[model samples]
Target chain A: AQRVTQPEKLLSVFKGAPVELKCNYSYSGSPELFWYVQYSRQRLQLLLRHISRESIKGFTADLNKGETSFHLKKPFAQEEDSAMYYCALSGSLGGGSNYKLTFGKGTLLTVNP
Target chain B: GAGVSQTPSNKVTEKGKYVELRCDPISGHTALYWYRQSLGQGPEFLIYFQGTGAADDSGLPNDRFFAVRPEGSVSTLKIQRTERGDSAVYLCASSLGRSYNEQFFGPGTRLTVL
Candidate 1:
């Protein structure tokens, strides 16, 4: 079964400091990874995906096949960046089934000003 | 364009009662999904629909949990004999054609069982 693990339950960083949220997955096939963010009173939304290789809101995640990790990183943390982050993995079943995403226990990030 | 929308933003019900949560996907999205989010945890996949057919219902916890997308645009999740454990925010999402497509989420319906 495909599984995602986010080790940290909570992470605190000062404004302007670098931050990293760890994520590891166990999947046999080539997996697509994603990072989702949910701010207070807001819906959970996509932040970045491994396949896109594009940064969003100054956040980036690199997919490491050898380590089976897709860790989200940001060079500078802003106070507004405080939110809950979830790491997710989608199994490749070739069609609409690919939309089924298995998510990890989210990590709460608090950027202190 | 309007994103995915869910009705009854908040619902409070007593145990053993029945409840229905609704979701309206994006106008052209062909795939829709339902997920349940408990406190302090990531959302758990419940079921998914491709057009009007249920492509995956394996994530559903039990037979008491049922869903339908009769018109292929709006979906309803019905739960019977609700228990306190069922109290959580139910989320809905939809994507264009589903092959690794990005999904847009709804605001979610918070269900509380008393």
Candidate 2:
């Protein structure tokens, strides 16, 4: 079994302030980690994935195997970034392509101007 | 092209009643998935379909939950004897292929079991 944990249910930050969303996972084998974001009244969409090793919308998450964490971070936060963020993990099951995502409870971020 | 689409954006059903939620995937997507999101939680996987066959359905909570994708395009999730605990937002997603591809999501159907 796999699990993703996001300790904070809500986070608030002033505009231009730095922000970080913590995410930890428990999986036996290698896992693919992702950060998903859902803006107000919008469908959930992928923000970034660990494998890509790239930044999206000023947000970046590094997968640390030693700590089993993939925390999303941004140097400067904007009001547009206020939304619900989810940390998800996908691992192969039984040697197949069953990439089922196990997600955390999610963190709702509020970036105030 | 349009992303995934789910029908009956909202559904209200009485206890013990059966309800069916619909999902229409992208035109050429071969992999479709269903997930359930509770009030404050992220979406939880329920089932996955590859073509017309279910590649995985392990995330389904119980026997009362079932889903089918005919012709590998549109999918339907059926819930029998709905309970209050079953109230949540049902999300549908699709990927070009199954292996770790980006899954496009729908707006989701808010199911409320009263």
Candidate 3:
């Protein structure tokens, strides 16, 4: 079985400060990782994926195989960046199910002015 | 053009009653998913549909919980003899396919059982 762990339940930072949301996963086979965000009163949406290797809203995440981690990072945090973030791992075919995602508990980010 | 949509943004029902939550996936999306989210927790997978068939329902809590996607566009989640423990935000999402693509989500339906 695949599992995701997000140790931090909440993170607070000042505007313009660097921010990082840590995520770790345990999977036997090749896994797909993704970060999703849910702003206040908004639906959950994709923030970034390891496969894309692209930054969204100045946020970027690097997949580390040795660490089994995909930590989302932003050099300078903005007020608009405050939201709930969830780290997810996609179970592959070899894991018994490939369609569903195993998600971490989530971390609430607060960017103070 | 639109994202995934769920009906009855809020639902309140009594225990032992039956309830059905609806989900309208994005047009042309072949994969749809249902998840349950409790307060302060990330969403938990309940079921997944690839086209018109249920590819997975392992996450479902019990036999009282069932879902169907006959037409493949819209799906319904049926809960028999709803219990207070079943109250939570039911989220619906859809993706282009059953692969690792990003899944678009709806605002979710907040179900409250009394």
Candidate 4:
């Protein structure tokens, strides 16, 4: 079975400090990893996906197949960056192109000014 | 254009009562998904519909949960004999056509069973 583990349930950092939210996965086949964020009073939105390989809001996550990790990172943290972050994995559904995601518990990040 | 939308933003019902939650996907999206988010946990997949058929229903916990997209655009999830454990935020999402594509999510419907 595919599983995603987020070791840290909560992380706090001051402004201008670097932040890293750890995520580890257990899957045999190639996996598509994604980072989703939910801000206060806002809907859950997609932050970044490994396939895009593009940075969003100065956040980036690299898919590490060897280590089975896709940790989300930012060089500097801002107060506004505080939110709940989730790591999701997508794989083949049945025998078709449709895919379903399995998400980790999530990490609540608090960036203080 | 509007994104995915769910009806009855919040619903509170007594245990043993039945409930129905509705979801209206994006205008042209061909794929719709249902997920349940319990307190302090990530959303768990419930069902997936492509066009008018349920492509996958393996995530559904038991036979008490049933969903239908009769017209291929709107979907409804019906729960029988709701239990306290069934309380959660049910989320709906829709993607263009393929599951790999970006999925737009709705605000979600919060269901509470006492």
CAPRI-wise, candidate 1 is medium
Displacement of residue A88 (Cα, Å) in model 2 is: 0.2
Error of 3 at B95 (Å): 0.8
Q: Quick one: ranking by lDDT, best first? A: 1, 2, 3, 4
Give one digit per residue, the lDDT tens place, for model 1 in B19-71.
99999999999999999999888999999999999998999999999999998
The sequence of per-residue lDDT tens digits that candidate 1 reaches over residues A21-77 is 999999987789999999998899999999999999999999999999999999999
Give per-residue lDDT, candidate 4, residue B110: 99
Kindly report which residue stretches of model 1 are placed more than 4 angstroms away from their true locations once superposed.
A93-96
Q: What is the TM-score of chain A alone in each candidate?
A: 0.96, 0.96, 0.95, 0.94
Error of 4 at A32 (Å): 0.5
Model 1 chain B poorest 10 in a row by lDDT:
B95-104
Q: Which candidate has the highest DockQ of all?
A: 2
Model 2 sits at an interface RMSD, in angstroms, of 1.3
- What is the fnat value (0 to 1) for candidate 3? 0.77
lDDT of 3: 0.94
lDDT of 2 by residue, A10-65 (tens): 99999999999999999988799999999999999999999999999999999999
Candidate 2 per-residue C-alpha lDDT over B12-98 given as tens digits, one digit per residue, 9 for 90 to 100: 999999999999999999999999999988899999998999988988999999999989999999999999999999999999898
Judged by DockQ cut-offs, the docking class of candidate 4 is medium
Ranking by DockQ: 2, 1, 4, 3
lDDT of each candidate versus the true structure: 0.95, 0.94, 0.94, 0.93
Cα RMSD for predicted model 4: 1.2
